[model samples]
Target chain A: MNQKTALHAFDQAVALESVGTDTFCGRSPEAYANMVGPYGGIIAATLLNAALQHDERQGDPISMTVNFAGPVTDGGYQVVASARRTNRSTQHWFIELSQQGVVAATATVLLAVRRDTWGDTEVSMPHVPPFESIDRLDIGRYLTWVKNYDFRVVQGHFDPGGAIEDTGDSLTRLWVKDLPRRPLDYLSLMAISDCFFPRIFVRKQQRMPVGTVSLTTYFHADRDSLARQGDRPLLAEAHAQRYSQGYFDHTGKLWGEDGELLATTHQMVYFKD
Target chain B: MNQKTALHAFDQAVALESVGTDTFCGRSPEAYANMVGPYGGIIAATLLNAALQHDERQGDPISMTVNFAGPVTDGGYQVVASARRTNRSTQHWFIELSQQGVVAATATVLLAVRRDTWGDTEVSMPHVPPFESIDRLDIGRYLTWVKNYDFRVVQGHFDPGGAIEDTGDSLTRLWVKDLPRRPLDYLSLMAISDCFFPRIFVRKQQRMPVGTVSLTTYFHADRDSLARQGDRPLLAEAHAQRYSQGYFDHTGKLWGEDGELLATTHQMVYFKD
Candidate 1:
């Protein structure tokens, strides 16, 4: 197919085929592969896509929590999106992704029909240089998934040769957008929420075994706002609060070019020393 | 029952009786009633309690996301806790609370066996006066659930007669603990995570229709550390990031008396003007 008629890598990676009932069939595309398995962000987007494509879906997703239970092999899997309860204005969903009859990941999604109301933003976006003013750090050679996004770091970039004593704070601020230029949407926004590298690598200047245990994202922007965002880069900022008992948790915020807060995400990560 | 023999109000509220293989029965006690229904915190704690009390449970909860699907009536409900996947070090749970076969709330819990590792707390506890120095704000007459906790507000107290022009920022820092002095535990900590009043009320300083759509909590402390806390008050701080489309999301941090970060919580709230 011609480049103009071809599907974007992200679209292919998250593409799902309806099978039977509320189940769908999906595959982990090679374009978004990570060091161990598929990039987690793509997996998250795929699980959310299941609900978004379900026939019984009620409204837009306001909250989603995904638990990475086991490693997802690079192959096909089945996703079951079950709408457990549907209220007048809200709906609750229980979703599971299974491979060979064994569950690999699960998610809980909250969908609601939102209306315009009194609105305010208490947290302001961080001031940073334009995306063009920053330099993109190319680490795609190490992790294939890094090639999917163009990252312009303002702070907290990893120093491969630096020692522990030279490490800095866990704060990471950057401007990021899809490499092939995909417009912003709930699915893409969900994927971008997990795009931040594990905070431990930036804080200690050392890479250890770490994976996200549970991730929760709250969507602040609706469809119109997200569509207006277009393919422009988003200002993303994240930081860790506490690292204890072999675990660490970080919170992040994503903002539109016009300073609109798009989403706020939180994750609990498991780390091995 | 005598005072010494009776269960604490919190314990009684969270008490569960096994019904079936993976199901249990619970209640929404009057002690934790809110303006419209039961307190969201107790509902969350009770849901987590179902998993904690399960026979196949492993480790402690590292993350939990509770979706308040429908109004939970002030009566008995059945909770079904299903362990979807149990890996060597981590376990994933899907829990649901239903009354008369109708689902009311659902939760996804991540439990893991945590070990000691190199740790640090990037976010420090805010410097505030001791709990004894701040006068407690009593609003138990309006919301019965408020009486279940001792709230010593450091700032952002509601002014029942104040105008919107005199409203302050959407930040609330207070020291809170269960009433009647109950020791701290995972169950109690889960409930306290949602103890803060809605941020919209603090920002607008007006009483409006509002309810939490989803709540998530990340536990940073273990059983031992929680035991050491022993009924001491915890410094709780929460603030909103954005309020739009009839929904607002907030993040909170809970610190022990010694300034150790205990838990971090987030919630998405729905409001009607």
Candidate 2:
């Protein structure tokens, strides 16, 4: 069986355009549908992948920031990337996600040369529970139009319907490795990052499905520990930020295997209940 | 003496040009300087404060996400915002940051009603080095342009002066908090998030004074802790995402006395140095 079965290109506005290389759209029907907008890690990861496609780019990416400038529509948009600066071990680029012919979001990436993998090869794995050990919840149980990403919570979950505010600080440790290991591209990671709400938020308040949004993430390190392994839990956390009118920002972190810092992400999620 | 205090009027944007709630030419420079972008958390937080100016938005915003659609430029851009959807205890919004006449970024926000707060919370705090006890370093010695915010490393000064072959996945923990307690607003927090970068990447990459280009964050919960003094250290994890392109993201968690999780954050940062 093929690992990633292919269909025609995505017909969604953004995802379809991503295949063209002119843009990177987070048209993933993952967990919350357009529910939470695009995942920040997806933005971080996708921008990096797109940057790699450029030959003029040098070094490895070590840092990136996705400023969720504004809402990027579910409809396709354009991305323009350019090297802002380049150094021996680090390279910087300014990337913009635009819709039609306008700018929707902006991001920057810092690529650094991978000094051949060296030193005492020790990684402190996270202490959270394993992915498969956690419970799985179907997003469809809630949002009818929302497609669900098969996700398990190693540290926390609100599925199976439970009382909330029974916990503290709204903290959670999770294992997040996507099903059908598709190389865990940053784009896909970002897409998946948009899947869930912090169990803390959902529990204490009304549940809201999310939609069209922008995101940004910082990739901590390559966490292939959950690679290809089905039933692994990807630990994640979504925190609340200041809100006004109808907007606010949130951040999440994903972990895999022995407590290793897998990925740190942020999303400009849009909430709809 | 105070330099200049800013005001964000929603009279025109919020009441008149409803969609133009978060655009430039309509925002004060102080507000503009603080946002990750036009509709970013920095400003959204300010907007949230304003949203509650009227009692309707108050009930305790459990969570909120903002969706951005157009480019909101500092010098010459327009911005807009909308509600993704709202039900019972939660609300969502769509924001567009426009520049010239194009949509640059989009964002979405989710807000929920908080009926209660976690009291006398008992939870083990994450293992973080004591920031105050650790000999701090003046980051300007290494990263000269940190004039935006004060950055202190609780432990080592992670800087890659020469060639480095990554031994394997590496991580370093740092204690970072804002300098001098000023009014904690969205822009201020947004600026603080910009300061997160793992020493690991700084130790291996090329150089320059880097700023947060794209920032995505997840907030776990709202807090009254802000009313208290901020001598606490925020634990930060900044590390690489992938080696080939040098992408990276960081996580930050803020806790209050008694070990309550006040906030958790993740950001995708673009490093130039």
Candidate 3:
């Protein structure tokens, strides 16, 4: 295994600099830059990281909703993560990302100490070829964030610079993992949850003015399960239900090697045709 | 026409007594009580209502996520809704529901002035029997919240007091509308998004302790479309992907009489086996 994993860079990017009580500063690295702002996934992971590293944090994150209210300036930003309510088993947190004294993005996260209980998977994993059967897609020139991950598209391919294929469906499935290879954790899982390509690009076969307005993710697996997935690619599927009235909704699910559901996520993206 | 709609009681229950700037007090009515606390839908709607009536609120609700940190008290509670970021076209608000001095629930809402653009629904509406064709599930004695809405199950029925049928799948389809008749709006839509029975209760014959830890909703239709849907029953479908580790996730979609998609919602519920 060629094991020069980019985990170090990922960790440095999400590591927050503490400046005050419950306040931290972070910056998006050039390797994961988007068109106008930092990659949404990295930004999300950074915000969640702030809460995880906080002194008052109680448990693991079970649910998080991040709202992109405005453009995130490409430079350094400040995050304020405050635990809004703390119960015996669960806690709620409110987080904000600000630049130049202006709020750019806001988020809410629910953390809980999970307990063992009877559980089952109701949704079946889609039958797809093994990871070794798919060819890796070249996204090095597409966006800064795309280059940081190794992606093999198993279905619904969209060529950014080629002819548009109107598949009449907005479904994309891929196997993805950190480029250099890194152990899975809450931070990495949070980033991977937002790593899907824009559904508009897949449906329309071309890029439009689109940005994710809000994102919500629910984590299903625990730390041990994630660690067991060390450096292994995750199978992910995403599709949009509606693309209308200047917005669209995308739902996605990520699964580990054993078909264990790792996370389920949903986001609404604003777009202009 | 028996125009005495359940909306009156809903409105009264959500109506807040403004005590100070951006702060209000609300109470749960006995008409919508659940096993322990009031219905999660009512609490969500009440939080959204506080932001809607706020002077600083901008545009309509595009996305809202309410986090149920702890059980809400039986009687009165205070809410503080503040606009965290106000852009030209979009605004983000953070809200908290508290009793005495302890925080009970928290929420985040994104409001936006939607623009006219090309839109389409990819998820086809589930073909179910007409609202009038299916007998309404008589849940009047099950919980107070059941009496607040008229629900007709079209698929995946479970007897609360009978032996459990372990269906391999956890899909549920139903037709539902507010009791009596009330015009469709954001508040009603918010409540309706959360009106689904717990997936555990639907999948298992008996109701184990279950509560929604967090809920998120994305609005697809605009005010004009919602106005056209006024008081009509909506075809709704909800299903779970996994139920494990003391928690499960459910996704739902609501459609109008004309098959127009109205909203998409997702929630994570805590359950004990």
DockQ of each: 0.87, 0.10, 0.83
How many steric clashes between backbone atoms does each model show? Answer: 0, 134, 2
The CAPRI-style docking tier of model 2 reads incorrect
Question: Which of the two candidates, 1 or 3, achieves a greater TM-score against the reference?
Answer: 1
lDDT of 1 by residue, A37-64 (tens): 7988899999999999899988998999
Task: Return the clash pairs for model 1, or none.
Answer: none
Alpha-carbon DockQ of candidate 3: 0.83
Worst 10 residues of 2 chain B by lDDT: B7-16
What is candidate 3's CAPRI-style docking category based on DockQ?
high
Worst 10 residues of 3 chain B by lDDT: B1-10
Candidate 3, residue A137: how far the Cα is off, in Å? 1.7
Tell me the tens digit of each residue's lDDT in model 1 across B127-188.
99999998877664358888889999897766556634535478989999988899999999
Ranking by DockQ: 1, 3, 2
- Tens digits of lDDT, candidate 3, A9-81: 7887788988999899988677788877888888889999999999999989899999988878767999999
Each candidate's TM vs. the true structure?
Answer: 0.97, 0.51, 0.96
Q: Model 1 compared with the native: what TM-score?
A: 0.97
- Any runs in candidate 2 off by more than 4 Å, and if so which? A1-32, A36-49, A59-61, A69-74, A116-130, A133-135, A142-148, A160-166, A173-175, A179-181, A198-200, A209-215, A222-233, A237-251, A266-273, B1-273
Measured with C-alpha atoms, the lDDT of residue A73 in candidate 2 is 51
